[model samples]
Target chain A: MEPKVKSAMQMKIQVRKKKTIVAKDRLFSFLFILPSILAIAIFVYGFIGWTGYVSLSNWNSQIPDFSFAGLKNYVSLFHDFRFQADLRNTAVFMILFIVLVLGMGLMIAVFLDQKIKFENLFRNIFFFPMALSFIVTGVVWQWILNPSTGVNLLMKKVGIEPMWYTSVKVIPGVEWGKIQVGIPIAVIAVVIAAVWQMTGFSVAMYLAGLRAIPDEVREAARMDGATEFQIFRKIIFPLLLPITISVIIIMAHISLKIFDLIYAMTGPGANFVTDVPGVYMFETTFRGNYYASGAAIAIIMLLSVAIFIVPYLLSNRKGES
Target chain B: MKKKWFAFLSFMLALSLLLVGCNSDRASKSGGNGTRLDIFSWWTGAGEEDGLKALIKLFKEKHPEVKVENAAVAGGAGTNAKAVLASRMQGNDPPATFQVHGGAELNDGWVAAGKMKPLNELYKEEGWNDKFPKELIDLVSKDGNIYSVPVNIHRGNVLWYNKRIFKDNGLKAPKTFAEFFKVADQLKAKGITPLALGDKEPWTATQLFEDVLLGTLGPDDYKKLWTKEVSFDDPKVKEAVKTFKKMLGYINKDHSSRNWQDASQLVGKGEAAMNIMGDWAKGYFVNDLKLKVNKDFGWVTTPGTQHSFMVITDTFGLPKGIKNEDDVMKFLSLLGSVEGQDTFNPLKGSIPARIDADPSKYDAYGRLTMKEFKKARITPSLAHGSAAPEGVVTKVNNAVNIFVTQQNEAQFIDALKTAASELK
Candidate 1:
C-alpha cells in the first residue's frame, strides 16, 4: 500500500515538471521573435501612417506646411481626367498581361518538361531576360518599337508598307477604329518589355512544379494505355493548378504596381499612354495637389492587390489544412 | 534557458538603441555648426559641374570659416531634383538655401505660409537696387519684400540657326513671320529638316508657342492669355495656335521621342536649319559640342515681335529656420553684389542680374542681349515667368503635348480653356 502511494506522488511531480518545461519553451519563443515584431510595428506601420497623413494635405514644391483638406483631394482626383485614364489603363494592363503571361509560361514549361535537346540551356535562355533591369530593357524596347527607327524600318526592308510608320491618326473604317493609334506603340513597347522580364520568373516556378511530378505515375498511365496528350490533359495539368494560381497572384501584384517600366519608357507627361496608378500618384504628389487623392489611389491599389491575393492565400491555407 | 533567451533579447534591444543613438548624435553634430550651409541646386553635367565648382570656390574664398555643402540632385530639366526638394520640404527638413526660378510659383505656398525669409534687409544693406535692373528686382520681390536673390538672367526667346547651313542654302535670317516661312520652305526644299525640334517635352513645344504668340499677338495678348484675363478660345489665341500648327510642318519626323539636346545636336551638325531654344543652348554648343557661337551658329529673336525677349531668372531662397543668420546675411549680400553677379553669371552662360556689368566683358550673345536690355526690349515669358502657377503650367503642358502630337485643334483649344479656368 505504501509503495503504491509513493508511485502516485512521483507521477504527480513529473506532470508538474512537464508543465514548467512547456512554459519555459513558450517564453523562449516569444523572446526570440520580439525584435522582428517590434521592427515591423515601427518601420512598416510608421511609414504607412506617414504616407496616409501626407496624402491628406495640400503639399506642393513650395508649401512646407500641409493643412488638412479632408476629402477635397479625393474629389479633385476623381475629377482628374488623367487619373481616370491611368486607372483604365492599369485595369486593361492587369487583365491582358495576366492572361498572356500565364498562358505563355505554362506552354513553355510543358514543352521544356519533354525530353528535349539542351533542356537546361533552353531554360537559361528563356530566363536570361529576367536578369536585366527594367530601365535598360525599357530603353532597348523603346528603340525597337519606335516607328521611324525600329520594326517599321525592318518591315520596310522586307517591302511591307505599314501606314503607322508615318501617319499619326488612326485610319477610318479600320476594325474598331484601331488603325491610327499613336500611343499604342508606346504601350506595346511597355507590355513587350514587361513580358520579356516577367515570363522567366513564371517559367522557373512552373518548371519546379513540373519536375515534382512522379516518374512512376507516368509509367502507370502508360500501362493503362493512356496517350501522352490524354495523360497530360487529365493528370499533369490538374496537378499544376496550385502553381498556376500562385503565378496569377504574383503577376497580378506586379502588374498593379508597375511604374518603372512605364515611367522610364514614357515620362510622366501628356504623351504617356501607359501611365499606371503608381505613376499617377507620383505626378499628383509632385504637383502638390490633392495628396489625399494620391493616397486614395495608393489605398485603392493596395486594396485591389489584397482583394485578389487574400482569397488566393486563404484558399491555399484551406488546401493545406 | 528561457532566462538566457530573455537576457539575449534585452542585449539586442540595448545594442540597437545604442546604434540609433550614435547615428542621431552624429547627424545632430554635423548639422549643429552655424558655418555649415546646405546648398541645393539642379546643376549637373561636366560644364555645369565646372561652373558650379567655380562658384563654390568664390563662395569659399569669401567665407573661409563657413562650410558650403552642395546637395546637387541632377536630372533633365530639374524634374527629379524638384521632386526630391518638394518631398524634403514637406517633411519639414528643408535645405538652408535652395535654387528657385524667380516667379509666382516659387512664392505661392512658402510666401503665403511665411516660410521664406525676406531678403529686403540684405537688398538695402548691399545696395542691390542700384546694382540690379528694376525689372529683375520686381520679378524677385513680392509685396515690396525681396524673397530671392536673382543670380542670372536667361533669355528664353532666342531663335538659333546653323550659320553654315543657312549660308549653304543661301538663306538669310528671317526678320518677319512671312520671311520665317520662306526660310523654312527653302530649308525643306534643300532636303533639310526646317526646324530642330523635339515635341516630347511639352515645354519645348511651349517655347515655339510663346515665340509665335509674341510674334503674332504681341506682349499684351501673351500676358492676358497666361494670366486668365482673356479666354484661350478667343479668335486672337486661335490665330496664335493656328500659326504654331503651321510651323509644326517644319519639325523633324523623329521629333516625337527625341530629347531637346538631341534636337540641338541636329542643328549643331547642320542636319536641321534652326532651333527655337533658350540662350542656355549656347552653353551646350560652345562648352560640350565644341561649336563656336556666331561663327558656326547664329541667334535671333523671333521676327516681327516688337523687340520683346522672354526673360527668366534663377534665384536663391533662404529657408525659414536657417542656423547662421549672420552667415545668411553675408551670403545674401554677396549674392546681390556686382562682383558676385559678374563672377557667377558668365560661367553660367547667362547675363548678370546687375545691369551695371560691362557688356564688353560678356560673350557675343551676351553682348547682344545686353544691347537688347539697354533698349528695354525684355518681356517676361508667361510660361517660364510668374504669370501662371504650377498646376496651370502642368495642365497647359499636357494640353500642348496632346495638341502637338495628335494635331487635334478643337480638343486642344477646349483643354486650354479648361486649364485656364483653374488658375487662382
Candidate 2:
C-alpha cells in the first residue's frame, strides 16, 4: 500500500511536470510567431490606422495638418469629376476583367484537360506571362496597341482601324450628373492587356481544380449513357464552382486596386477614360500632394477590395468548420 | 530544453532589434564627417545627363573635398522624382539640393509648405542681384525672399518643325493663328499630319492650351489669370479654349498613344509638320536623333507669343533640415555662376537663367533665345508647373484632357473656373 501510494505520488509529479512542459511549448511557439505578429501589427495595421486618420484630417498640402475635418475630404471626392470617372472606370474594369479571366481560364483549363499531345508545352506557354510583372506587361501592350502602328498595321489592311487606347468613345453614353456613365472603349484595351497577363493565374487554379476531380465522376456519368457535353455541364462545371468563386474573388481584388499597368500604359487616358482609383490615388498623393484626398481614394479602394474578400473569407471559414 | 528554446528566442529578438536599429541609424546618418552632397534631379536623359555630369565635374574641380551623389531619378519631366523628393522632404530627410521649377513649384510647393529656407543671403553674397534677370529672380522669390537659384531656362513656347517638311510643302513658320491655319490646311491637304501632338500624359495637351492662352491673352493678362486678376470665365479665356480646340483638329489621330518624343519623331521623319514643345526638344534632336539644328529643324515662337518668353527654369534650393548646409550653398553658388551656366546650358539645349552668361558658348538656337530673353516679357509657364500651384495644375490638366476628347467648350470653361478656385 505504501509502494502504491509512492507510485501514485510519482504519477502526480509526472502529470504536473507534463503540464509545465505543455505550457512551456505553448510559450515557445508563441515566442516563435511573436516577431511576425509584432511586425505586421506595427507596419501593416499601424500604417493603415495612420492612413485612416490622415484621410479624416485636413492634410491637403505638404505640411501635415492633422486637424480633424470629419468626412469633408470624402464628400469633395464624391463630387469631384476625376474621382467620379475613376470610380466608374474601376467598376467597369473589375467586372470585365474578372468575367474575361474566369471565362478564358475555364475554357483553357478544359482544353488542356482533354489529355492532348504537347500538354506540357501548352501549359508552359499559357503560364509564361504570369512570370512577368504588370509594368512590363503594360509597356509591351502599349507598343502592341499603339494606334499608328503594331496591331493597327494589320487592322488597317482589313480596312478596320480601331484607335485602340487612343479612342475616347464611351458606348451607351448617358450623361450622369457630373461624369458620363458608360463603358469607356479605351478601357477595353487595358482590359485586354490585363486579361492576357492574369488569365494564366486563373488557368493555373482551374487546372489544379480540374485535376483534383475524381475520374469516377466522369466515368459514372458515361456509364449512365450521358453525353460528354452533358457530363461536363451537369457534373464537371458544378464541381468547379468553388474554384470559379475563388478566381472571381482573387481577380476582383486585383482589378480593383490595379495601378502600375494603367499608369505605365495609358496614364489616366483622354478624359480619364483608362483611369482607376489606384492611378488617381498615386498621382493625387505624390504628384499633387493632396494627401487627404489621396488617402480617401486609398480607403475607397480598400473598401472595394474588401467587398469581395470579406464574404469569401467568411465562407471559407464556414466551409472548413 | 525549454530554457534553451527561450534563450534562442531572446537571441533572435535581440538580433532583429539590432538589425533594425542599424538600418534606422544608417538612414539618418548623412553629411557627417564625409560631407556628401546628394544632388537630385530628373535629368537622366542623354543630353540632360551629360549636362548634369559636366556641371558636377565642374563643381568637383572647385570643391575637391566634397563627394557629390548624382541622385537623378529617371522619369520624364520629374514625374517620379517629385514624388520621391516629396516623401523625402516630408520624412525630414531631404537631399543636399534638388531640382525644382523656379516659380510656383518652388514658391507654392516647397516654400509655402515651410520646407525650404530663404536663399536671400546666398544671392546677396554671390552678387546675384545683377546676375539673373529681375523678372527671373522674382519667380524664385516669395514675399521678398529668394528661395532658390535658377540654373537653366527652357523657352516653353517654341514651335519646332522639320525644315525639310516645311521646305517640301512651301510653308514658312506661322507667326499668327491665321497663318498657322493656312499652313495646317496645306499640310492636311498633302495627307501629312499638321501637328504631331502626343497627349498620352495630358500635360502635353495642357502645354498646347497654355501656349494658345499666352497667344490669345498676351503675356500681361495671361499672368493675371493665376492671380485672379483675370478670371477663367473671361471672353479672352474662352477664345483661347476655342483656338486650342481648332488646333486639336489638326493633330495626328494617334496622338493619344504617343508621348512627346514619339510626336517629335513624326516631325523628324517628315510625316508630321510641327511640334510645339519646349527647347528641350532641340536637345532631343541634336543629341538623340543626331539631327542638325538649324538645317534639319527650324524653330519659331508659338503663334502670337513672339515677345512673350514662357519661362520654365530648373532651380536648386536648400531644404530646411538637410545636414550639409555649407556644402549645399557651395553647390548653389556654382549653379548660379556664369561658367557653371555656360558649361551646363549648351549641352542641355537650354539658355542660361543668368543674363550675364556667355553667348559664344551656346548653339545658334540657344544664342537666339539668349538674345530674346533680354528683351522678351518673361512669363511663367502653367503647363510646366510655374504659373500655378500643383493642385490647380492637376485640375487644369484633367480639364484640358477632357476638353481634348469631348471638345465641349462650355464644360471646359466651367472646369477651368472650378480649377482656378484652388489658386487662392
Best by TM-score: 2
lDDT of each: 0.74, 0.90
Please state the error at residue A29 of candidate 2 in Å.
Answer: 1.6
TM-score of each: 0.89, 0.96
Model 2 per-residue lDDT at B409: 99
Shift in Å, residue A280, candidate 1: 2.4
Over B1-424, each residue of candidate 2 has an lDDT whose tens digit, in order, gives 7888789878798968866995775465563867579899999987788999999999999999988899999987897999999888888778889999988889988899898999999988999999888899999999999999999999999899999989887889999999999999999999989999998888888999999999999999999998999999899999998999999999998888889999999888888999999888888888778899889999999999999999999999999987789999999998999999989988887899999889999889888899999989999999888999888888888888888888999999999998898896
Candidate 2 C-alpha error for residue B318, in Å: 1.4
Q: What local lDDT score does residue B200 receive in model 2, on the 0 to 100 scale?
A: 87
* Tens digit of per-residue lDDT, candidate 1, span B1-424: 6888688878788868966985784367346564477678887766556666777788889899888778889887676877787767766667778877787656664565577888887877777777777766766777888899877888877788999988887889997888999999988887889888875556788777878877877776776675678788888878888888889988887676666787888899888889988888899899878999899999888766747767787788887865666766667677777777777777788887777786776888888787676556555665563656666676777677767766777878898888777665
Candidate 2 lDDT, A27-110, residue by residue in tens:
878977877788899888998888899999999876789999999999999988888999888889999999899999999999
User: Judged by DockQ cut-offs, is candidate 2 incorrect, acceptable, medium or high?
Assistant: medium
